[model samples]
Target chain A: MSQQKILSRPSVGAFMSKYGIVVIFVGLCIILSIMSPVFLSMRNITNVIRQVSIIGIVSMGVTFAIITTGIDLSSGSMIALISVVVATLSQNAMNPDQPVSIVMPIAIAVAISLLLGIILGAVNGTLTAFGKIPPFIATLGMMTVARGAAALYTRGRPVGDLKETFTFIGTGSIFGIPLPIWIYLAMGILAHILLSKTKFGRHVFAIGGNEQAARICGINVEKTLVKVYAFAGFLTAVSAILLTARTSAGNPTYGLSYELDAIASTVIGGTSLSGGVGSIPFCVIGALIIGVLNNGMDLMGVNAYWQQIAKGVIIVAAVLIDARKQKRG
Target chain B: MKKTVLVLVAMCMLILPTAIFANGQQEDGKILIGAAMSSFSDKGQTYLQDGVREFDAENDDVEVLMTDAKDDAAVQLNQIETLLVKGVDAIFIVPVDISALKPVFKKCKEDGVKVVIGNRMPAEELWGEFDVYTGSESIQAGILQAEWVAEAMQPEGGKVGIIMGPLGHEAARMRTEGNKQIFAKYDNIEIVMDAEGKWDRAKGMQIAENWIQSGANLDAVLCNNDEMAIGALLAAEGANLADDAIIIAGVDATPDALEYLGAGLDVTVFQNMNAQGYNGAIAAYKLAKGESVEKWDWIPFETVTPENMSEYK
Candidate 1:
């Protein structure tokens, strides 16, 4: 038995580290299915995916940030800021004869949304990389500033009466799939490619793995960090636009506490908060885990108070698993 | 690091100026009224503030200085102190939570600042502290919404689900209690499950979707606010539930939810927020004038349905 334990440790550790989170995800699904038969139904599955998509997309960017040993606290506030701003741009007149307020073409608004994301993200990145400020402090500051800006921009009122086509990005479905789900899948693939197939992705890993060694090996740490944060910010903008479209309004209070969810998804997906080692697929799985938990608990008639407790426990457990794995390695 | 710090400060400069509502100066011969708002970021609150601003814009003798707490209870406390220091004769307050009452009321009383509550209500016991309370009853909102939804279900009372705002929130708790009081009267209408939606649309949408997928012959979806009701409507549509199969009701006749009234949403309660704000300011003005003010300025919560939605719109 002792000899077998000795022989099996290396392979098992490597295998578990690679696929442990996926296993947890599947285990959770099976458990939820047992608790409620509808948990695995086609409709329920679709619902869960749709629900997780926003945070899932945000988590992809967060995964990149985490892999570079950084964080993004500004995602939530950025969502509110972007949504309210973009909603104004894509606004439809209450009636055709009435004067609309600064309505732009929907396409231009979307483009501006993406540009806004890149700029805000670049700010977070720049602060961390060149400003030498910790990502947490930098993004935290941005979070406050962005939320305040959203409120100031609209004076605390929601920007609604959106163009129908703009709302379709959130509400419309194509070929039996919701638009948000399609966006999630598309963003996931794009992020995976950017992280795994490019030199930029490697530099990110190197920075997170050992900044001193990465610098010695001639990786442009500052520039890469900036790009990484910009990517995260850009993704936040996409989410912001989608959410505004879905709800048919852009309230300044939107996306409150969502940063914690995105960060939790990244962490639970096996990304180390200490920085380094994360995956996009794992991030998606992590968000799904949360979605299922919410769906399942609500279905079972669990108290809302208990739902919060269970979520907290699960988040802690995921971090514990990651910590334990790192210790053994 | 210094450059980034400078940049961050520069970014803050853009927003920080909005927070400084008063320069602690009283204009010559003008009555200064400080309005401590719970949030300038909420539509309802904005409407409330607009009512006061309109009052401000019209009168040259009274200048209204407004501060946004951004929905922070602690910030609201500090804002009240700032208002007092600015030597405002009276303050219009929208408390973020009940946290402001005891301390803010005590401080205002000590400094002889007249306090008038508007929009949302504070805790029951603390109600005595404020000079006047002018707002619609949240309980009535729930009762009106619940009564309408219950009546809609008719002879065949059906299973229902409730989506609430943040737990322990005064509005969420009282509104829900109001709903329960009415729901108890119906024999056929049964509440299957209820969960907090955190006053969020996405959370509301997901909760509705999960209830639908659970295959509970859900007859109604009741929400604490219009955002959740609208979300539930979208979820119900997403699930292909027949339009007439479910009764969805929400409080607060917000525009987005009003748009869905006939199509998906069944009923919503209009709290007449602008009137509440305008009246609250008037009450404060009366106190400033040393005139006797009524303790309660109760505004009626009107129920808005498809038939009456046009009026609200």
Candidate 2:
């Protein structure tokens, strides 16, 4: 009997800890649907998914970074910078009608975004690891610098004239699933595999749990942290490209406030703000919760100002619940 | 240190005469027209500079002294005080904040310096206090766009959405209110969503795409300005909804908006921005010359569509 009880205790604890976010998400969904009939419609659900995809994609990368007890406040601004470059390049390509096809533009955008991500990540990682600067300060500086650079690039105007094919990633669908949503899912799957199956993932968790101990165990702490930020940058670039495609224009102001949403979603999904714990699926759920709340508020005719206030309240409530869980532990 | 001091002394020598001459020339023989500009970037600067230049070009009798407050109400007030101290005949102000500029207007009235406000309208008491108020009616711009949409959609009375600028901004609020007035007249028309794009293109695109993906069955979109309207067009094109020819309309006859209209992509209400600059100068010049002027002056706007876009082109 004691053996059975002991076995059940682990299962119960696991259930309580892991499934709690999912339960709350479900509960919120039900309540919102009851409050507004439009919330339950398939169309609205699809809309919510589409709206969440960009933030969800970025948060997946953030989940990996946060698992290592690091933060990236620059992701939002980085997305803006990379997006303008991508859009400007694509616009030029469309106008000249060069021998190179649409695929060439996409390939070029991807390469440029990857490079930008690595460079930005390297800057942040170097400051935090070598210069002994705090992660918050380093990333915060990067955020302002990147946003300023984006504004300078466009000179406070929107870049336009992108080819139709380039916009497909944001608007196109396969099997009735929007392309951004699919891209987000694909990235999420890859992230899940990397975190759950790889030695790198284990190292990340170890470092996040206790950096000093992880270093003693031969974890090459600095390199791992750099790689995590680089990955975050990569994800931010992808979100930027999708945003550009969706807008069919490159704008310096794109993705404003995205970092906050990403961080909020990560924390809401049981990824402790202090770090050492996170799951891809849970973070995705957190993003969806935000998406649903925005969509429901719109459908219910809530004023724009009030919607912002509601979002703040919901975020606070979710964090409070998480805080309670941590206290109990 | 010696070189720095020498350079500082040289700069002071160059500036002292200009300052002294300005103060000396401020008497009745020279009409001192003080201009308080909001900022030196984008539309505000463009208008203020053009106004001052035009005023100087047309009238040799009036000498315009200008100060840029960089969009700070406090700096603008200080600039007014400095201009007042110099004993200017009149002051032209493009205020940063309409409400906060009242005391400056009141001070101008007490000093008997005619105050001509450009672009922004102050509260009723301040308006009554000022010599002349000139600006485009932003609400009329919105109503004009809505009326065009209503005509295009005709009997079906299409479902519409709006991508608006920031709330509480005069232009945004007035445009929205004007659109609502037109919307109230249409029995079949329904507004699905009105999202704040914050006068940003990407934000407009995001909101537009979301509205489309939500299956809102939207037939048209009206933006408070051309920037957001272009954004909506891009989003609709990205979503392949452009084939439906969802009507898109905006205010502000910017070059890009005109280009889009020429391409048969969107409609716009063309306000005479250049005229706003020119007429503002004329008003300021008249006030400085001690000529009587009306308290309020209205600038007209024309609706531009694919059919008449060639004329603008």
Whose TM-score is greatest here? 1
**Per-candidate clash tally:** 1, 0
Off by over 4 Å in 1: A1-14, A94-104, A325-329, B1-27
In terms of DockQ, the best-performing candidate is 1
Using all chains and alpha carbons, the TM-scores for the candidates as numbered come to 0.92, 0.78
Tell me the tens digit of each residue's lDDT in model 2 across B33-142.
78787754343245446757776777777778887775678888888888877777677777888677777777777777787887765666665767887777888888
Question: Which pairs of residues clash in candidate 1, taking residues 3 or more apart in a chain or in different chains?
Answer: A156-B41
Poorest lDDT segment (10 consecutive residues) of candidate 2 chain B:
B39-48
Question: What TM-score does each model's chain B reach against the true chain B?
Answer: 0.90, 0.86
What tens digits encode model 1's per-residue C-alpha lDDT throughout B1-313? Answer: 9999999999888646434433332546677888888888777777788889888887787878899888889988888887776778788898888665577788888877788999888777887788988888889998998999899888888888889999988889888989999999998888888999988887798898888888787999899998889889988987788889888999999877887888999999998888888888888877876788998999999999999888988
CA lDDT, candidate 1, residue A232: 98
